[model samples]
Structures are given as C-alpha cells and as structure tokens.
Target: MKTLTSLLLPLFFFAASAASAAPTANSILGASDAIRNPGGAFSVTVTLTEFQAGKQVDASTLTSYSRTQSNGQFASLVQFVLPARDAGKLMLKNGNDMWFYDPLSKASVRLSPQQRLLGQASNGDVATVNLAKDYTAVLSGEEEVQNGERQLRKAHKLALTAANPDVTYASIEMWVDAENNRPIKARFFADSSRLLKTAYYRRYQPQLGAERPTETVIIDGLDPKSVTIMRFSDYAARSIPDTWMQRDFLPRFQPE
Candidate 1:
C-alpha cells in the first residue's frame, strides 16, 4: 500500500503543476483587453509624432470618443484636431467598416485597416476594438524581455491568429506582463507573414478607472530609423449617442 501511495502522489503533483502552468489563451487575451478598454464609453486625445533618422519630422493630433455596445463590439468617432489643413476631418468606425470624411470634398470614402495613418500607426490603430473578440490566441510560452530601462521583465508570449478577414493584422505576436496582464510589446504581421511593425507600450497612467499605457511607441520593422510615438491624454467618460455611430450621419455630425 505504501509503494502504491507514493507513485500516485508523484503523478498527482505533476498533473497539478501542469494544469497551473498552462493558462487558457482566451482568458489571457480577455484579461488584457479588459485592462485596455474597460468596457466603457470614454474620450481621449492622441498625439502622433513621426521621427526620421532620430529627428522629429512631423506630428498630428486627434480626439476620439469610443463606446462599447451590448454585442461586445465598439463604435468610435475620430476628428483630427491639429494641422490646419486636416482639421475637422472625421473618421468613423462601426464594426468592420471604417469611413473617412473630408469636409472640403464633402465625401466619405471607405478605408482599409492596413492603411497607414502617420508613420507606423494605422487607421485601424485609432479604432477602438477588442482584439480578443476578433482573434484566436495561443499561448506560445513565457520569456524575459528588456524594458525601456533595459531591465528584465517576465512576460507571457502569445501568438494571435485572426479568425476572420476583417482584422488589421493576419497574425500578431504579443507579450503581456505576467503579473498585471498589461501588454508590454507586440509585433504586427501581414498576411504573407512579413513583420510590418513593432509597438511598445510605455508610461502607464490611471485612466478611465484603470491603470493603462498612456503612450505607445512604434518602430518600423524594415527601417529601424523610422519611429512613431502616440501619446494619449484627457481620458474621461462621455455620452456617445447611437446616431454618432452611423456612417450616413457623418455629414451632419458635429464635434463637441
């Protein structure tokens, strides 16, 4: 009986350890998204700066309001704030469709998620969407990565595969902080599996009832000298009406 009990104890402990070590990919992705979006309607200003050869080249700013619907989807309205020529330009995202409106032309044109916005940032980057709802996540492993200060930080590495055709990136490799579930780094990939860009989340600040990354720095995958920094500020809860989410309402909509 003693011999049988010893064998069973070892097997039980091994199984328990394996179960604890393996975290479900969906749960991890969901937790990370919750930290980012927080399932509420809010407003924020994003300032994008472009750099070339380590020098500042150009910059733009935009204000956006986002709200999550009952179906777990997001609706957002974005209006360009800086750069006099582009001021009053509006972009609206309703589910998978994105539309850009120009006041001068009085036209609204459809846009693809892959289209570039400033430098490394994309039109899709401004859209408020939950990635966990769009992609299927697979826990690849965990590793230590160097932070902005060159200090080692442990993170859970995840490989995210797009479940449908509407997503911006076909596949994404992301690293989430092991303890807080904050996304530390991410690599965006094209359909052909080519690396498009790399983004690093930094300068975490309290916003919309949670601590979130206030700035995102993106680097060009092919050209290491090119960089873009997006600074987020003025986060507050706002009331976004249903009329603002419709594409046909773009001409009549007015920014508050």
Candidate 2:
C-alpha cells in the first residue's frame, strides 16, 4: 500500500499543477492580441483584393498609420494610395469616432466601424485594434479547427461579447492556436445575432520584429463564394503625431 500511495502522489501533484497553470480566457485573448498587433506606433501598407466565386474583381492599396493611446486603445489614419481616382481619400479613427474624408468634396463624413471598406473587409478591419480591450472573453472549449492552409489545428475557442458599444462587431467567436496563442479564426456577428463574416488569420511572416499574420482572409458569412484577402507589407516603426489622427487634419495631411 505504501508503494502504491507513493506512485499516485506524483501523479496527483502533476495534475494539480497543470490545472493551476491553465490560462484563463482573458489571458488567452490578451496573448492573441499581442500576436496580432505590434506594440507602440507603426505603419504598414495594406493591399485589399476582392474575389467572387474564385474570380478576382477589385483591388486597392492603402497605407495605415497607427498610434497607441495612453488608454491602451489605437488611433489610426488610413489613406487610399492606389487608383488615382481615389487618391487623397482618408479615413480616421479616433476613440469611438470614425470619419471618412474626400479631398474632392472637402468633406468629412461620419462613418461606422461596421461599414464595408472593401469586399468583406470593414472599416474596422483595416484599422489597428486590440480585441481584448473592447470585448469580454469567455473560454468555450478546445477543439480542432481548419486553418487557412486547410489543415487542422488544435485551438482554444473563445466566445466574446462587446464590453461597450464602440466595437466593430457585437459579438465574436474566436479560435486561437493553443500552443502559440496566435489567432486562428473568428466569426463576427451583428447585434441582431446575424452572422456577418468569418476571418482567418494566416500566412505568418517576420514583420516589425515579430512573426505576425501577414494575410487575413475574410469570407462573407452568408455567401462563402464572396471573399476578400487583406495583405500586410512594408511594415516600419513610425512616429504618428496627434494631429494626424484628427479629422480636421485630413485635408492638410500629406503623405510622407
């Protein structure tokens, strides 16, 4: 009996340690956020490509400048860089407010984060955001989910609901890689509980001192045939001034 007790004692201790070390849902979300976004201010060029039924339709390029606020939120300025016709157009996200500026009209119009920018990509999608700040997360379970490469990966599924009204989506179901805490996939939903889109973060590459997902594939929830690919490149640490994030500065803002 003494020998059996000794053998089981080590097993019990190991089990207890494992349980205590398990990450909470909020911590997992925070880790995933760190993997998705770089710390501090930076700039990256984004190319959005739209596809319908596997056929290419439209494409555009934009440069996004982002700065982290003292409150741990992001303020962004996205400028349209491609297609001469749309050149000089700007979108600014400051706190809960979002605005779109058109140089032609010299007008800045209020916009919603849910507004579609390109294909299935929303105005919120292109901007720098930290999900852990905007939503409250709950761990659902661990499961095997299909990745962007069509391979199965063990992921931690998390259910998230908006902590405030200023978020892009009302609720989201996300899956993060269990091993690395990298974001795998997410399903975005509207306030009416309607499915909006599904996003898969894939194509990890070295960018801005970390291995971040360089490409995000977004699929329309209702129509899987409609897709948009958002590719990130030309990453560099940049100093974004406070004036740049202001809507009034959009007209005078000149790209350097």
Candidate topping lDDT = 2
Worst 10 residues of 2 by lDDT: 247-256
Each model's lDDT? 0.88, 0.94
lDDT of 2 by residue, 187-229 (tens): 9999999999999999999888788999999999999999999
- Candidate 2 clashing pairs, residues 3+ apart or interchain: none
Question: What lDDT does candidate 2 reach at residue 43?
Answer: 94
Model 1 C-alpha lDDT per residue in residues 116-162, reported as the tens digit of each score: 99988999998887988889999999899865445679999999999
